[model samples]
Target chain A: MNEQPVIRTQGLTRYFGAKPAVYDLNLEVPRGCVFAFLGRNGSGKTTTIRMLLGLLQPTRGEGSILGHDIRSLPPEARARIGYLTEEHQLYDWMRVKECGGFQSQFYPRWNEKIFRGVIGHFNLKPTARVKDLSRGERAGLCLGLTLAPEPELLVLDDPAMGLDPVAHRSLMESMVYLTRRSDRTIFFSSHQLADVERVADYIAILDRSVLRMCCSLETFRNSVQQVRLRFPGPPPPLPDIPGLLQAFRAEGELRLTCVHYGATTEKALRALAPAQMEMVPLSLEDAFISYLGERGEKSFILSETEAQP
Target chain B: MSFNITISTGLNMPIYKQITDQVWLAFVTGKLAVGDQLPTVRTLAEDLVVNPNTVARAYADLMRDGLIESRAGRGVFITRKRKVFTREEGWRRLEPLIDAAIGEAMTMDFTHQELREAFEKKLGQWKHVKGGN
Candidate 1:
């Protein structure tokens, strides 16, 4: 196992004219870990990824990928990292086999078996022209090309985007298979929380242009929790509790969404003298929604008739 | 041995815990027997479309519980030694579970006698299954 982090950045920032796309970002991705980069759309995920791979220049600060500086990563180092973007770019004029032949020339460690396996699993024919393949087929071909080199680090930007259910399952199977080896690392940005919960060991949440949290998946899930307190009538004013992300009322019960629901928070809630108190376990998707949603906003808006006592 | 072990991503429990629980259930239900070879971590992960580390963790937990053992160069296999808890250990594990059951029963308006009867019925059903096995 490599002791050093596969990727690292220090105050990496990017600006588009007057507006900052990504601001003062710091990240450290350890080797052999499937790191999920999660955020809302246009939350600087792409900008940050682009900067890390040296596709775009950072407005300030610097970063490294696999120990090579991002500003000047050499071709040899670049060949050891597989990058798959949302767009599965390939020459429309080339055949599937021709594409593989063209890609294999640049990498000395290309594995024909992996390429063929992924292609066959996706039911793609080598003779088929790139232009004739479906969207999912194109993604599979890109994935095959990416995995054929067996890169030590895989950086994917929404690999599941625009893929159908069947194609998404194939992508997941390929990723799970890759997890068999502990020497390789995958850093991906995705909106698919369910998939992230299953595969990711570590995660870094980017909110807007800033980094909100970076921790283990379990840690993050455990941190964000919902507590339900039932009152005899209407719930009393919520006590001032630290780490409270959101609080609202539903069915005359006060529901509190908190970052860390420890003993201190429990004691504070107990002081409210509710008739009953319960802790509700949240799925990863629910937790993510609560964590990112607007704080202290009512979950639903009731009309005049529905709002009657 | 072939058995179906399905997991729901929407559940609050972690994926590894779900895998371990299902494997144990398979053993108890006679779907898996002693010396039955379990799938490799990689194979199971692929089938389930989950991270291999989660499957590995499940295997590790099963091994720790004496329910399964890994042979050198071979895949994991079900072990003969089913964990038999001592009276104290059994109580320690079951106390909270019993408490929860009783609490729920009471909330649902079941009397003490009704709760005891339900418990005995469950025990009888379990015994019948074990006897057939």
Candidate 2:
């Protein structure tokens, strides 16, 4: 493992005019790990990626990519990074081969073999014009270009969007192959939690321009859990237990979502001694929903609660 | 050989079950053999951007099924030489999901033939890719 993080941000903030897009963000992406930047639509994920790639200037704070200061570094620093935006546009008139050839001129270390392999694997037709490719094929072409450059880091904004199952799986395999061989760091943003859960070693959940959670994938999984308890009538108030992050009630039942359910919260729940209690392990999607709810997003709710104990 | 696993969000099946099923398929098709090292839970989790616990749960399930084993100071590895899936067991494991998918397809105005054709096509593709012939 590389000792220095490939990407580091300290209080990184970006604003659109007066509206804050990303606020006081601090993150460390360890070298060679595929880090997932997760968020709902318009949750500062794109803004953060833009700032990190030097495509947009930050309003305040600092970030370093490959040890180069993002704000101070020229395009040369960005030249070492491969970034695929969500709305990636390709020239419609150019043949797939022409585009690949054109992109190769910008990077000195572009790998023709890998490019050919990926193109073949994705079954992309070099003779076909960019306009002729399907949405998923277009994304695969962009991925081919990105991977060919052999950059130290890859920043992908929803690479899986609009892809069929086979294409998505192929793209993911290419990413895995790249990371494993080159030890490249990948920072990808996606609304697809399942994809994120599949490829990312670390995760950062962003919501409403704020960093909701950031941790290693292991820690993130270990920390959160969904607990189910049925009450006779209205549920009692929850105890103010440390590590108990959030709680709410459902139909004659109380649900406690915890960050790290230790002995204290267990004892606290046991104190209630409901008719029946079950601890259901949560998936990443469930955890993401709970975290977002706690931040008052209002998209989903646990239920009406009596009060906090 | 390491295969990258991707799970579909819109699919009705649980993500862990998908992982387990894919890994088992890989093992059964000779794509992954005994002693082939599996990606670390963290690496696989990051690739999928899922919580590590979810992948760990899948790993634990695989271990329980005797498909993979964990080695101290190393990592998980494919253990089963060949998966033993009886017809009934396989159907029992997959029937509910297939039924749900078929129901969903029907609701989307897909004819029975269309649904069956799609399944056959996917099954053919899987065989072609995994057969390595």
Candidate 3:
């Protein structure tokens, strides 16, 4: 319920040599919320996460995590944060329990109870060697180590990748438990939109090295709507609706996609008074694609029918 | 009581509907009850890191469905008992999806017996689970 942001970035930008990887990224993640970082592959999600963790320096801009300047904070600040990369690399020679013991030494807030719970919940053998574990088991072990630290903020990059359904469920359950008990803030990136949709309170979509949209999951759902209309002859010219994000014309039908389409857009569409009009609800994937398509190309507008004389 | 909402990405279901359905299920099952305040639109949005509009849509749908109501000052609340689905209604709702899933399972080399056994096992597990009635 705290109003202050746990993570905030202002005009953040990062580049891979001459190429801009992330541009003008301005974001604020509230405390104690599960923030889902969403994007296609190579959309600067990993880069952004690296910047926030201070593992990579931003070419420009500034930010803070837990109110401490990200760039200036010492390892102590990061120690208070738990991170799990998409590729969980643990010492191959150590036992799962040994890994936990070694990792616990670095964090002052390590929670043995939570650690044991996660290990048991994942059905991970304490004596299993990291090298001998399956990919899913290793990932679970990484997650177990991360959760055991009990950091104030947990940043995960695709924790569910390569996990079977049961392991995935356990990971999610562990996340829910951690968030509920500690009010820890979780920021995770995933190509798996369903998992993002499952547990995230906030979602940010990135595409082509730019942030396409960022909002609460609820707002994202309500603002976008799919409208289908059929007009006599070729479709009628669409009006300039303030929130129209994309429009397309096909087979004498006009399809309009809009963001923040409420009573206002409905009124505008009614003014055209097409022969047939229907508002179809759009799924999050459809909406994300629509928005990303529009953002990718400035000329990309929703198809509308040609104007009648 | 605490409740968690999960959306499945592997399935073809929409995230908003997943949110809506799961939250509805939570309310109906008594895991979340009348007067239980759900997270604010922005809080949940940030948690999921999705557009606030998406979460808003689910909340709006829930409001329209009468499962949860928005109090002017307090926030959204679970307002009613869960609706019990009749066998016909349940079949009506699930048959098509189940058919599709089974079809896919068949293509993946699952025999009918295997699929039925898996489902029976899942149902038995659900029956034993606490707090999901």
Candidate 4:
């Protein structure tokens, strides 16, 4: 088995003239793993993907995809990796079959059977004009073309964007199916936490032009929590609790979001003598929101819970 | 149906642990018996829409715990050798949980006697419903 990472970057930075779009990004995507890249709007996800694909050059640092330098990714190197953009860009003029034919010519190893199989799998008409297809169908068609090339590395920039729930689920199912192939590596960025939860083994969350968290999905979930602590009166200013991501104060209650909540954190809270304390596990989206949100008046409303001594 | 295994997409529990817990529960509840075959990792992953590696890890852990075994060229089969838990052991496991419940009830204006009577009544109902199964 090849041990080299499919994607790697070292201090990858990009600036759009005066504004820094991506800053000091160092990422490593292992071979054959489904990796999800998550960030809010304009968080440099697209800039990073564009840089990795060699379409946009970084102002500093360097990266590589499939052993080819990102600064100088060869056309052949680019061909080995499939890419699906947020829009699922395709020619509106070509018929479905003609679209497949046009894509096949560019890839020397393109399998016509697989192309036809994917088209048939999605139940897309071979003769329908791209302009006539619904937005979801166009996304499916784009996915089909991306996969038909049999690329070893597949990079998707928010494939679930603009797709309905069913369409999103179908797209994710296709991604899950593709990961069965031993040599295929999929890196997708999306706002759909539910879809990401379904398919991603590893995840990277970006914030403010910098990579925030990158680890296995299990690790990310295991390490964060939403804790509720009730006091006699107003809660005091929280002590410097380790892994305290954010804390919100309300009437007689302090709601805390902590990363890596464990024995030590528990001990610290016990010292405070709260009437009651409960560590609740957050859903993936809740965790993501808490991680991104600041420590001001929290939007996480405290659910009513009376406390006993 | 072999095992109605479902993974909750919550941070409360890891997916692998959920898979392991669901399988173990199925066995202890007699829903899964000895020699029952489990689905392939790929199938379960697809069904749950999770990573195959996560499913594989769960299966591997179950094998390590000796609750399941893999037969070459066949598939994973339940081993059914886990130790039997007495009622006391089971209740011991739930002691802290009941404490937490009572704690909350106290906060909600229920007296200790009232809460105890309610719990005992519920236990009686469970005994009648379960029929010593």
Candidate 5:
């Protein structure tokens, strides 16, 4: 395994007019880890990715991708990265095989077998024109092109955007195949939390221009927990619990979402003297929603009365 | 052997832990036997559509627990040897399982006494089944 990070940035800031899109971002992506960049819409994920790939200029600070400066990444270094953006850009008039043929001309390391295998996996015909393919088929074509070269680092922006369930699974298998060698690193951003939960080893979340959380997938899942406390009556006022992401009441139970839930947090929770309490496990999506949800908002009414109609 | 492993993300456990538990269950239920070959980390990850490292961690845990062993070039295989744990280690491992069960029971409004009686009744049935076998 390589000792150096595949991608590193220091004070990477990008501004649009007067407003900041990404601010003072310092990130280090270790070698061979499947890093997922996550955020709500317009939260600087694409901006950060564009800056890393040198597609967009930054307002200030510096960064490097694959050991080359992002601002002046040479053709040779750029060729070693397989970039698949949301737009699956390909010539509309070209046939599938023609697309591969044209792309293969630029990279000396392009593998014909990899191209054919991925195409077959996606059930794409060699004669299919780029304009005739569906959105998912086009995505498959782009993935085949990007993967044929066997790039050292793959940067994907929302790879699962328009993919169906089966196509998404194929994409995941493609990723797993890439990392089989233990040296291929993938940096992708997606709104598909389920897929991200499955494939990502590390994750960096951009919360509205701020780098909110960056850690391993397990660490992220474990850190943000939901605790449900049931009282004999309506729930009491919640204590000033640190790291409290959200607090809500529903059906006489007070539920709290907290980050880095530990002993002191448990003690404070216990002091409320609730009739019952238990930590509710959250899936990655649930935790992500809670982590980003409004703080201190309460009330989720199941029904006005217990009597059934 | 026809191997089928399913992973559920909705569980209270992590993916790696779920894998280990399923393997453990398979071993105890005789679905997996000693010397039976297990899928390689890469194959299983691709099959499950999960990170290979997650499967690798589960395999590492199974090996640590003495339920499986990896042959240098061949692949991972189930082993007959089960680990002998010290008392403290045994308690450490069992504590979480006990805690979860009790927590569930408590949430369902069961008292400690009721849980104890239920456990005792279940144990008696298990003993009688073993005796009949």
Candidate 6:
């Protein structure tokens, strides 16, 4: 694998008027990993992606995509990237074949076979009007078109949003098919953690427009955990423990979430003399919420009764 | 030949871990007999809709642990290793979980005697469950 990062940013800052959308952010998306850009709603994920693609200007600092400066990206440089917007915005009147033909004109490396293969894999008809196709079929058509261009990098912005479960699976299967090439890099922003967990090898999570976490999915899952501790009686106040991401206490039962969790953290919790201490695994969603909770103001831990929902 | 392995890919447990655990369990229980060719990494990844590398990692780990081995140009297969080794590997992988569960039981105020008896009963109930597989 090439050592060069396909996307690199330093001190990347973007503000919407007086409010900061992304603060001095430094990010590196190396070549060939399915990188998931995650964040809560309005967390500047879209803002950073826009800046990277030169669609939005950053207030301060610099970014580079595919070794070209993001701000002054040459028109021709855009050809090397393909983007799938959340909404499939192809002309509704155009037939599937027309949509593919229109897009093929823009790319020098367009491959009809690859396009047809992906289209056929989705079982799409050449003459089907875009307007008449279901949302999933339209998305599949867009994907086939994107693959035809054979871009080195693919940026998808919540492409699965509003998709039904079967549609969601179809989209994911298409993405898996794409990864077989091994040289393609995918960067996308999404809130669907379950799907993210499946396909993303690397991830960067933004919380309140701040870069809260970045690492491989395996490393991320391994580092954070929920440890349920039991004391004979109501546990004492949690007392600002280091490495504690979030804490929930209700009578005799307590759950402590930890980040960069290791033996040292476990030992500290053990010293509190819990009758039993069991380390539990956190799903990607669980870890995401717990990490947000670590920010103090937005915690995932709730009172036993408030947690029913 | 088609192979089917079921895993709820991304709920709490890492998918790769789940993959390894399931494969290991199958091997120990003899459901995946010696010389059984496992699905190629790509096939399994496509089947599960997971990062191919994750499946490859699970297979790689099993190879490292001597549970499975891959032949060049021929797909991976379960090794004709001793069932005792798989049983030992089982303990290594599951001991922590067992310990934690028992710990949790104790903290919940179950007596040690009660915990021991419960584990015995549970083990008796589970011992032959996989024997059918």
Q: Fnat of the models, one by one?
A: 0.67, 0.11, 0.16, 0.62, 0.58, 0.80
Output the worst ten-in-a-row residue range by lDDT, candidate 5 chain B.
B124-133
How large is the C-alpha RMSD of every model relative to the true structure? Answer: 6.7, 11.4, 11.6, 5.8, 7.0, 5.6
**Reference-based TM-score of each model:** 0.87, 0.69, 0.70, 0.85, 0.88, 0.88
Off by over 4 Å in 6: A294-309, B1-3, B80-95, B104-133
Q: For the second chain of model 2, what is the TM-score against the true structure's chain B?
A: 0.62
- Order the candidates by TM-score, highest first — what do you get? 5, 6, 1, 4, 3, 2
Worst 10 residues of 3 chain A by lDDT: A300-309
**Candidate 2 residue runs with Cα over 4 Å from true position:** A74-76, A230-234, A241-252, A294-309, B1-133
Pairs in steric clash, model 1: none
> How would you class the docking of model 2?
incorrect
Model 4 spans > 4 angstroms off = A230-237, A250-253, A296-309, B6-14, B61-66, B84-98, B110-133
Per-residue lDDT value at A108 in model 5 = 82
> How high is the DockQ of candidate 1?
0.54
**What is candidate 5's local distance difference test score?**
0.84
**What TM-score would candidate 5 get against the native?**
0.88
Better of 4 and 6 by lDDT: 4
Please state the error at residue A4 of candidate 3 in Å.
2.0
User: What is the per-residue lDDT of model 3 for residues A1-309, given as tens digits with 9 covering 90 to 100?
Assistant: 647798999889998889999988878888878888888888899999999988889999998998888888788888878899988999999998999899999888888887778888889989988999887788788888898877889999988888988888777666655655445788988877667666777787766777666677656666667787767678778768757777888876789987667777888888877766766667667877776664334332221111110
Native RMSD of candidate 4 (Å): 5.8
Candidate 5: misplaced stretches above 4 Å? A229-236, A250-254, A273-277, A296-309, B80-84, B92-96, B106-117, B124-133
DockQ of 4: 0.51
